[model samples]
Target: MKSVKGHLRNRLVKARKKSAGQANIWLFYSFKLDADVPIIGDLEMLYWVSELETQPQVRRFTMEHEVEISLEELGDSFEEITVTRVEHIDGSIEFHQVASKQHDSFEKVSVPVRYKIENRIEKSHLVVIPAARLKAFSKSSLSFWLKVIAFVSQVRGYDLRYEMGQVGTSISICGDGTIETLLESLSITDPALAVGAVCRSVLQGNIIVDGLRSFGRNTRWRTP
Candidate 1:
């Protein structure tokens, strides 16, 4: 890849002891090389979130960093991870990262990530939902979204989306455009199938919401 400037196109140097590997920084949604992901620069956790972005995406990302380090001291074994920053429409900024199998390694890496918002240096705030608390959020909203997620999980997604224009139209008319309202308006004969359609709509990137928040019937949705 070349430009009129004749730069090395776009490259993220991964230094190695013997020989370095040259690869492109395609952290998926944030396509720009060297782009920051909230607090976590492009790393493994960012890639995990990228995978989830395909279905039920969250679009609250702000600019990422070149590199943001944690002050916590680890003896030597360091693992690369990413922390994500999301900016909501309500002027709230949230920091989150992927759940890691290496629990010890993940501890205190991005501890107290102090960030700025609206030109003010806010206090250090970090959020990583424990598995139980996160699951509890889902359990409360289990009536609808659980059904949708379950249906989507049990069946293969659409290989070819012919025409779902009505899904969008129905959402547009629903009050506040919430998924629950959308389902009600859809009037699909089989309610489970309607839930399946909602899941598909989300997977197709037609519907997006902040999955980090405690979401349920009242969760707001939008078209992209």
Candidate 2:
């Protein structure tokens, strides 16, 4: 039984790596001022260093990962930009912009991501999906995963909740459910599905509950 468990563990790890290889992870950052800002007509530039591994032996793999943004054309009098943001729609995006009396510089900001396995029996990997995509998905097809998470949580004797906030997205699942069981329950075998499930599970119940409450409040307000 111990050996069998070990074999299963190895297989799970391999599967996770394979899935990750096919994963399309994205990062988006936005900077909004309380008021509009001035533009000098010069293009704004942004760049970031990423820690993605590149394997030379793999023809599909590249050794370097970097992101850059350039905004060259701008109106001189067009001061007061409401918001300034950069989105890494696909792949990774990172950068920093700063202003000061002495000097202005762009620094590298690190966005950390964590992935882990839960429940040895079920083999579920807890992954943190990007927030931009969460917002996009929440606009469509979010309820499906909510039901899946709720059902899976109930079946596996776990409390599964998706918490979406202004800052980012997160998922909480606690009980005797294993990672494998959680993944299986979601019926996710591909990278897209895996990431989608993570994002869905994270954004599910809270937004729905909040919307329902808001609706009820509005209805009550209108009630004579």
Q: After superposition, how far is residue 54 of candidate 2 from its true place, in Å?
A: 26
* CA error at residue 197 for candidate 1, angstroms: 0.8
lDDT tens readout by residue for model 1, 1-224: 55411221111122232211453243232211113333222233233243323323344553332223222233322222234555444565555544423233323222444443455445333444333433443444334443444455543443323224557677666524776888777746666566666766765566876554454567678866
Poorest stretch of ten by lDDT in candidate 2: 45-54
TM per prediction: 0.36, 0.16
Best by TM-score: 1
**Which residue pairs in candidate 1 have backbone atoms (N, alpha carbon, C) closer than 3 angstroms, thus clashing?**
36-64, 36-65, 37-64, 40-83
lDDT of 2 by residue, 100-137 (tens): 11222223222321221142111111111233333433
